[model samples]
Target: MKFFIKLCIVGLYSIPFAYLSVQTDYEADSKTNYIIMSLIIGVLSYFCGLIRADLPLIFGNIISFSVSYFCNSIAMLDKKRADFFTPINSVEQIVLITVMSIVIQVIFYKLARRFAKGYINIIESNNIEKEKRV
Candidate 1:
């Protein structure tokens, strides 16, 4: 049960991480922004994982950088149909992407945490009911 709960929490963090990392348009001027955003996400996920002392959480958070970079490269080619290494030529683009990443990260983290809590509550309630019946 604990393992399952841990998996759920980690998944909650990762699924969106993969999606958004791929979706971001990293140009030269905005590459720094991407790196900074990645670092922030990495830190948030790392702490969230540490909440349970789970192995998967620790490793997943650690590997978040490579995961995001891989997804970004793949998405650049497959989804956006753009070249893999487009540099951000403008400061305006950097600011826009950075702000957008921050907002999206905040929203996703809140939702994932809420979902994990709700899931644990349901499982715990079920276990209590079973114990009472026994």
Candidate 2:
């Protein structure tokens, strides 16, 4: 139950990140591509929290960005692939996305640990207490 709650929290946070990312390239990336990016980011963040590895902020962002780049790359259709890769501004675009990912993940890491430690009230472990009161 705790795991699910944490996952959901991260997932919820990702929606804004996706929106901001799309704003960076409103003409370039479609809505569906960013939706997939949000899902991937949430799942990666969840695993990073579970691993509790050393330097999680550094490691998690690196892994998350690498996966997202590939996913975003693949999400592009064949017709756009050639035009997308050769543009002079492509490097600039990637850099912006990288920075956005870092900012979002860093904020999540700061807040998620605090949220996960407390009782969220979204889940009730004992219905028995309410039943007895009734």
Candidate 3:
């Protein structure tokens, strides 16, 4: 099916994003930077999804990247929660981060898909209005 093919493509495309997401070097030191980086990842992934006509892919990328960023930000900002997070330099921590990121992506996909649909509807409506006036 077309959906399966698109899924495969998105999976392939996500390899680099996933790899980059785990790098401690990319970690944000402040909450502001974390938000900014997440947005950057989301925008880039959204375009990839648009190109593929795949909402799941968009959500997957956005959720995975944002969750990873969030976890890191929490570790950096909160003393209490900091102890719960695995240190970035450890292999166990890297695995945990990767697993959590994927789990969040799967769990939140439906909600993200709904939001994407609403966004698409707004864009379609705007285009329809423009066409009617032309």
Candidate 4:
């Protein structure tokens, strides 16, 4: 339940960036691609709670990067290849990609830190209570 709320909030937060990634004429496809990316990030991050707090932002981004990059590299969706902020040359493309990656990391970290803190605490406390009874 809490994870659902967090996922919804993260989805809403990512929408603007998704819209911004559409550099080509296929506006709908581009938006869908990024929305999918956001979902991948959110779901993976939510599961990361089993491990540690920041693991979602850390490991989730690392794992999701390849999938997102593969989706970006193909010409089928956005020709821009995940480049944000209107980067022109290859160097600019690299720079913008890096920038977008950093932005995503920050956003994911912020959302998880805010929404996940209480939920993990609740779970831990409940587990502690159950252990006391046993």
lDDT for 99 (candidate 2): 82
Worst 10 residues of 2 by lDDT: 11-20
Model 2 RMSD in angstroms: 8.6
Which scores higher on lDDT, 1 or 3?
1
Q: Pick the candidate with the highest lDDT.
A: 1
TM-score of each candidate? Answer: 0.38, 0.43, 0.33, 0.38
The CA lDDT of each predicted structure is 0.52, 0.52, 0.51, 0.48
User: In model 2, which residue pairs have backbone atoms overlapping below 3 Å?
Assistant: none
Question: For model 4, what is the error of residue 46's alpha carbon versus the real structure, in angstroms, after optimal superposition?
Answer: 4.6
lDDT of 1 at 125: 100
Model 3 regions more than 4 Å off: 1-8, 11-14, 24-88, 112-134
Model 4, 22-118: lDDT tens digits are 3332444444655564465455454444334453344434433444344444543444543433435333443454457556655665666666787
Residue pairs whose backbone atoms clash in candidate 3: none
Candidates by TM-score, descending order:
2, 4, 1, 3
Worst 10 residues of 3 by lDDT: 28-37
